[model samples]
Target: MEDGLLSLKWNNHKITFFEILRVLREKANYTDATIAVEGKFYPVHKLVMSTCSEYFSEIFERTPCKSPVIVLKDVRSQDMDALLDYMYLGEVNVNQNDLASLLKTAECLRIKGLAVPDEDPTKFRKGQSDDRRESPPPKRRRHEDSSSQPLSQRPVSPTISASSKTTPPSRTPPLQHQTSSLPVSQSQDSVHDSIVDPPPMVKVEMEEADDPDDGYSRRDNSYDGGSVNEGDGDFGTELSKSEHDPDNYGSGSFPGPSIQPGGDLPWDEGDSSSFPPEGFSGDLPAGQQPQGAEGLELGWLGGNEAFRCHLCTVSCGSSTQLQRHVMTHTGEKPFSCHYCSHRTARKYNLKIHLRDVHGVPIDRRFARY
Candidate 1:
């Protein structure tokens, strides 16, 4: 027997990360530190700041203060907010006019993974190969840190070093806010590149029909084993072509396929009354179409369903849609709320439930419902 190591990337990693960031931004719970920039206080997670910025990392490691308020001077509120956005999310946007200030703030805080205005903008794109992003600069000692104020008292003037920067200030209401929306005058492609991973390319092979003059080409309707992720039982099975056959219309207990426009279906040319002509049963194997069935492939119906659920009479228009739906019958829900016992078969439903029931912000990755 051979032993091997295996790694699995969670499909909802992005969602989970965004959810945690949402909690932090909302100051929902577990926040242990505050940062004051330009007199605007922001409640923040110390661990998150330490992990993202060496400046915060040094301050937390050297100082033994509880719930300390770090005063960051010479930084605008919007600039700090932009840095927070980049730290929590993977990107940030600032107006071209303010780009220099944002970059200076990023440099001051020693935040990596952000491109300078003069650098190749793609350097900070999310899908880049390196996980650690840019290399960290060498550590240097600062004399200004020794002359800083004590952590027990608030300083009238901000200190330049980590040791003197942390202190307790009178608690004030943090400005209620989401991420700062600094308008970018850059090209759409650059903004998109910085924020989103490039969409995966799908290779679709087209096949000519048995009759070349049929005026319709069939997409490779093969079942992709990869489509249904392994170890996810709630993903269910794909819908079958027979389930959506036009011939099945009015022939059985199943509903008719929605007739879309511009389709030259065999039934469209001939009398609709003679759809399931003679003794033809509407039932067929998963990927096999009914005999003599001719029409343009329903691309929207997942091209052709190559899998079928053995448990139910319910039919779905698309393969992935049916797979997600089948879990409702099996009582298998992979998506569960972090705050409650609410479980949902679909991730989108789980997100909606979180936003509506638990007050968590809607994930920016998902379209607003």
Candidate 2:
């Protein structure tokens, strides 16, 4: 839907229906099949891609290569599950308020590289010369130092080693370095007053030291060779005992209803505060159990609400989608690939991706970026 609501007072400014229709009809974006999924149709009066999302259609059209399989051999199934989430929702929503690992399955799966700004190459790396960029050449140096120099005593062209009219001999003697240091009292106070170490010299070096460990902790630096908490005595015994102790009062009780501990059943939705115990016998109902236990019991919902990925023997939240994804490996070429860098998953998208990114001819329908 068009987010803009066109409004105006009739006597103040009345908009004609024809003008509205003209704007809707004449907009180049009204051309068919840009935003809608293929084999699906859209209303001519429907707002254009740009009317709602500026780059939506452009990103959709990008193309990649034609590798029929996505071999994420090294990735875990749980991470693959998250990637599957994007297939259905088009984006992943992650928890930000708590400490939970944001897991994205590393897909050697030739399906598609994430097509978004956060994943772009330029963003992943920063500019090389940003370090060398000079700060606005000290403001005081511009306004104070040069201007404050004594006008009467400053270097002048009239002071000559030899007069210009008398041409020196061809064999001129090499001039000695004769730049006499200016007296401290006569020196520009602004320069001397401002001369101090720049923060960047130290800051840049420190940043360079941290560059290697952005991804990995090669050595145990969290607890450096010395103690982690130097001043405080090591109360490892008490800290460990408290940190690992489970809150026993929070367990074995059901919410608003009597539930067999560890029993696999639906908890009463009416109340969810009191949860079951950790060592309790039966599988507790999901809601009445621990707050975080619900996600791990993931089931694949598929064709006829079946919860199994028959092709992969895996489970997904949506069975139909899972089925369709499995077909990608059968050389269906549902997404065309442009064979420049790597393969793309969808055929039509490859055309758009190639045109926008590589400036390549769209004739080869399989290319993807």
Candidate 3:
């Protein structure tokens, strides 16, 4: 244990020392010698120069001079500067033109670790130049040529030309094709058939034969059970026994088949009066009632046909619509103005109030409504 060897390591010591030497060389500090190249004197450290180059080491060893000013003949100042940088920092940057001169100077100075250039330095350079000249140029692509030209100046492609030159297929008109495919007689017959087509007839089947003079219909008899007599004649009964019965009409006056005003009954035929009134009694048939708050009659909306509001008798197209309608009667202010206590049953109405009363910008979400 007493004779054991110890090794301490500083990984960056080489680089750090090089950096210090470089700084010292730049400042001309601790330089014990001078290197004169091309009439330019560079202060240099003998120890550093001798350590890097054997020629300098031999000169120093032979002369035993403390501080010698070495005169370098046939060497460039720029080359000397590069060599000095190499000696200090272990790296030198020389371009292709100056690299040959730098290498020659380095060889003459016997600078260690400086790579020697090839005997014929131009061979590789000549080969590179020749390769660049001899290598085939990239083939001109069709698309590249077309793209290089202005769009209007570009030549029309063969595909486009062929398409342009080629004529489109001639096609028969639909009516002509249909008619031509059939025989001439058949074509005329079809035309005649279309022109002579009969109007659709809706036959009204009844349990008893009806007299046009009497206003009674199957609908009236369906609701009034005791009014129609059993002796009523159907199409299957004897013609002689098919007698008109006045008692067949309800005991109460016939009432002339009263039609509720402002009712959208099937028989109303889009009459202006059929459009619902402001607040009409919806005491109408199932298919005749007005929708929304105008109709407060819920009895006809039963039988799962229409959605009737519980809060009011207004029938809606759907449950969601009915829920919205019920809000009116319930006075539910589901939507409220953020700026004030004003509230509304509908989002559209709220938007209107905000725009008209509050002067607030309508939210983008409510803009559509």
Among all windows of 10 consecutive residues in model 2, the one with the lowest summed lDDT is: 222-231
| lDDT score at residue 52, model 3, on the 0-100 scale | 66
Which candidate do you rate higher for lDDT, 2 or 3?
A: 3
Cα lDDT tens digits for candidate 1, 1-369: 156767787999878987777665665256555564443445567777776654465444433334444544434566576667666665564343444445445544545433111222233322323322122111111112223212111111121111111111221122212223322222122333343324321111111111121111111211110111111222322211121111101111111112222321112222211121111111332243333332312312332233322112234565455545334422334567777777765678888988998788986233211
Candidate 3 versus truth, CA RMSD in Å, comes to 51.9
Q: State in Å the error of residue 305, model 1.
A: 77
Superposed on all Cα atoms, model 2 deviates from the true structure by an RMSD in Å of 36.5
Clashing pairs in 3: none
Which candidate comes out best when scored by TM-score? 1
Backbone clashes for every candidate come to 0, 48, 0
Give the per-residue lDDT digits (tens) of candidate 3, residues 285-341.
333224432231223334233543221233567645544543332233446777677
Which candidate leads in lDDT? Answer: 1
**TM-score to true structure, per model:** 0.33, 0.16, 0.31
lDDT of candidate 2 over 186-228, digit per residue (tens): 1112122222223222111101111121111112111001100
What ranking of all candidate models by TM-score puts the best one first? 1, 3, 2
| Model 3 Cα shift for residue 269 (angstroms) | 99
Candidate 3: stretches off by over 4 Å: 1-5, 115-369
